[model samples]
Target: MLKTSTTNVVPEKKVEAKQRQGFRLNANDKYYASIFLGPSLLVLTLFVFYPMLKTLYISLFLTNTLGNTTVFTGLDNYVKLISSPDFLSSMSVTLLYVVAVTVLTVSVGLLLANLASQKLPGIGIFRTLYSVTMGVSVAVAAIFWLFIFNPSTGFFALMSGWLNLPVVNWLTSPTNAMWAVIITTVWMNLGFTFLILLGAIQSVPSTLYEAADVEGASSRYQFFKITIPMISPTLFFVSTITIIGAFKSFGLIDLITKGGPTNATNMLVYRIYKDAFYSGNYAKSSTEAIILTVIIAFFTLIQFKFLEKKVNY
Candidate 1:
């Protein structure tokens, strides 16, 4: 019936043009699709892309603090950072923190994820409790760790007494403040990695495990050789996020130490904040900001260029 109607009314040119315009959404369809997707694209453009471009532009200028003038400095900001001891020191601390956070978070998260993936009794409760850390705010988590590490009157003293270890000033001392930051960051961030890894572990095919059993492959070997490789993508994703987050770690430092003890834990992000907001040195802050952006950009590009490689399932 439709074929007869089309043969009756349609011209050859009209039919040919309709064929050329195949697969496009009609107006109503486009309207609904836009309703679904428009908001998200708007948000991405406004919050992510807009600020990124602005930051890149601001990074090119030299600002005067008192007079409130921004002059074009070109790459002079980056040049100063390369020659500055303070910037280099902060970068070193940031690098160490990123390494520590990634390793500890991934390790602890994988261990908990493996345990929680089991069919053991009361596993659901344990997994939920383990994941609660992910819900805690960064400042809240750092404050919680402070209470846990109070040398004179906290859990560390009680634990130290039980284990006969020395009570340490976990926050006040330069030696332990950075370590405390790393430990707390690890504890708080591990839940995200755990959730990702839990899914990966559960997704491993039962048939593979059965085949491993038939071949007499030990559980340890099967996990190391098969499960680890199968879950490597999740691990890689979490590692990348962890590194980026650790590099931009200002909240913990601000809430916990404020980069205290004579700049013992002055990370790049903290230095940028201090220079911009606290010290009123907008020019230097812009320089530091540019450096931070470059570091983030470099790592993200590396992830995309090489480390972002996908595994065939």
Candidate 2:
């Protein structure tokens, strides 16, 4: 009886072990995973992946005024853009704008985040006030700044007249108009950067500060060595997205400068718009759009490769 029982148990154990060695998920897990991932996959395929592939296809064709394919042009559109003066100038302008916005936004946000992180009375109110711009849409913010920067009737006009100072045109001159757009973009993005860094700063362990205090570390020293390093991860994220946002900016440039005063503020996105609608060159526009996408992807890869290495976590 004992021998028969052992034989039966050993066979059952071997069968169970073999089943476990095979790679399989229970039916419930597969069902739940499908339920959770189905909509996102469908949406991405329909909206993002499909459109991107279609744009690549369209870029290879010559199109009529109605954007229908007229002929197969291959890479002629891309080669044409490479030699075009407007495209080259717009690429330069885009690089400048992206660099300016990313640097200034991150710097100011880090400064304000430190201020807001302090445990002072009514600090929450101050944080709320600073973050108010985050609630504003780009169109609304552009229009709001338009009112303030209007040379004849805006805030500068009102104040300059009162003080008898010569009024400076904020949005008309070529040099000033570029800076004006940059200022608006930075201000509009400040609230988002500040809030993200604020949370990162707050999450830092209190014991670290206490230890620094006991070691006679100065506030500046602690900030540079401890605070910055601990919050580097958030800084990396904010800087990356800020660069992308600056690259893709269109509405503010459209409303404020329209790439105007001799194309001083014209960036790649506005160039794409002009080619697509104003010039009625769908093939050229699609080619430019693909190039812009590649530029963005390249920079994003660089950031992840080099910049992300500095992040603490």
lDDT for each residue of candidate 1 in 193-256, tens digit (9 for 90 to 100): 8898999999999788889999999989988988898888778878888888898898889888
lDDT of 2 by residue, 222-270 (tens): 9999999999878888988898889999999999999987999998889
How many clashes in candidate 2?
0
Candidate No. with top lDDT: 2
- Model 1 clash count equals 0
How far is each candidate from the true structure, as Cα RMSD in Å? 4.1, 4.4
Give the number of the best model, judged by TM-score.
2
| TM-score, per-candidate, Cα-based | 0.82, 0.84
Cα lDDT, all candidates: 0.82, 0.89
Candidate 1 stretches greater than 4 Å from native: 1-50, 161-164, 301-313
Which stretches in model 2 have alpha-carbon errors above 4 Å?
A: 1-40, 299-313
